[model samples]
Target: MPKKALIAWGGWPGHTPEQSAKVVRSLLERNGFDVTLGEGTVMFADPKLASFDLIVPVITMSTIEKAELQNLVLAVRQGSGLGGFHGTMCDSFRSETDYQFMTGGQWVAHPGDIIDYTVAVTRPDDPITSGVSDFAYRSEQYYMHVDPGNEVLATTTFTDAHFPGIGGVVMPVVWKRRYGAGKVFYSALGHNADEFAVPEMALIVERGLVWAAR
Candidate 1:
């Protein structure tokens, strides 16, 4: 049977959640997944959430009810894979520490807001990044507080121009971790749907999603 995927999107409009969802849904479908699209967090409250092989959240800076959040958490913990990009995953529930803990990071700020930067493939041998070379792009360079246990696949260096304190600091651009038996993947690259048009960025995210699926 084909793997099932659920994509729930809705939050800050500036991030173009709907457009991003459509882009991701297409990718998933093309990859042989049975995709379901949802409009809000209420979809997360589904008791059958764990039935899907993968869950993708395109929401940004939005709130989820306690029950809905808990259900999503339980689904992942019980072996439902969770994967997403940018603020949708890391910046979704700011007040929920458990959600952040499971995701392996949280977006704190973008130092320069749509600045040019290079993404270095730190783990080129890894399946998710193999054969993909380092590439440069113009987008929000996310500065995130990440979990030490995460296996970082790609990273970027921050300069002193924007945040002096983080000068020369390396930040994880893509990573994957395990929550219970579930695989969790994330990338701090997609600022909008159009950003995925960058070949390298799109490939990395597509590979990450497949790797994260249950």
Candidate 2:
């Protein structure tokens, strides 16, 4: 049987949550997953949430309930793989430290929002980043509060282009971390459906999704 996958989208729609969810649904299905979709944080509280092999949150700046967060975090801790991109995962629950702890980062700001930047693959040998060359990208340059334990695969350096005096600050663009027995992966790429068109962005997120699933 194919592995089970759940994708839930909600909160701010500016990120095009529905479209993002659909893109991921297609990708997961193509990778032989039994995909399920949910809207809002309601699904996060589902008692059976941990049954899936992977969970993807296409959410942004949404408030999550205590029960919902507890269940979701517990799911990952008990081995439900979690994967997502941009603000979808990391920026979802602003008030939940546990969620941030599990996801490995929180979106603090996107300096120079949607401008040209370079994504440098730090771990070229990692499966999720292998064969993906450093590429020019036009999207949010995420400045985040990231986990020190994360295994960073790709990064981008900030310049004083938009925010002055912050030059030479390298930030993790893609990373994977362990939350209990679960595999957690995130890419600071894919701000919208259009970004998935970029080969480098698409490749990193696609491979990262597959790599995160149990």
Candidate 3:
């Protein structure tokens, strides 16, 4: 049977969650996944959430009800893979520590807004980043508080031009981790669907999604 994937997208229109969802859905479908698309955190209330092979959240800065949040958490903890990019995964549910802990990071700032930056493939030997080289692009360079346990696949160095305190700090751009038996993947790239148009950026996220799926 083909892998099942669910994409729930909504919240902060500035991030273009819907357009991002379309990009992700197309990739998932092309990769032989049975994809389902929905809106908002309400989908998390589904009791069968754990049955899907993968769950992708394209939402940004939205509140999730405690019950819905708990359901999503239980699904991942019990082996449903969770994967996402940009503010959707990292910036969602800011008040929920458990969600942040599971996703492996939370966005804190994008100092220069849309700025030119380079993404370095830190784990070129890893399947999710293999054969991928460092690439430069103009977008929100997310400064996030990431989990120490994450297996970082990509990173970017912050320059003093924006935040002096964080200058010289290398931030994780892409990473994957294990939540119970589930695989969790995330990328700080992709503020918009256009960002994913970058061949390297698109490939990394596509491969990461497949790798994260159970």
- Look at candidate 3 and give me any clashing residue pairs: none
> What are the Cα lDDT values of the candidates?
0.95, 0.93, 0.95
Output the lDDT of residue 84, model 1: 97
TM-scores of all predicted structures = 0.99, 0.98, 0.99
Candidate 1 vs 2: which has more lDDT: 1
| Per-residue lDDT of candidate 2, residues 75-185 (tens digit) | 999999999999988899898898899999999999878899999999999999999899999988999999999999999999988999889999999999999999999
Error of 2 at 143 (Å): 0.6
Model 1 agreement with the true structure over 1-214: per-residue lDDT tens digits: 9999999999999899999999999999999999999999999999999999999999999999999999999999999999999998899999999999999999999988989999999999999999999999899999999999999999999999987888999999999999998999999999999998999999989999999999
Model 1 misplaced regions, further than 4 Å: none
lDDT of 3: 0.95
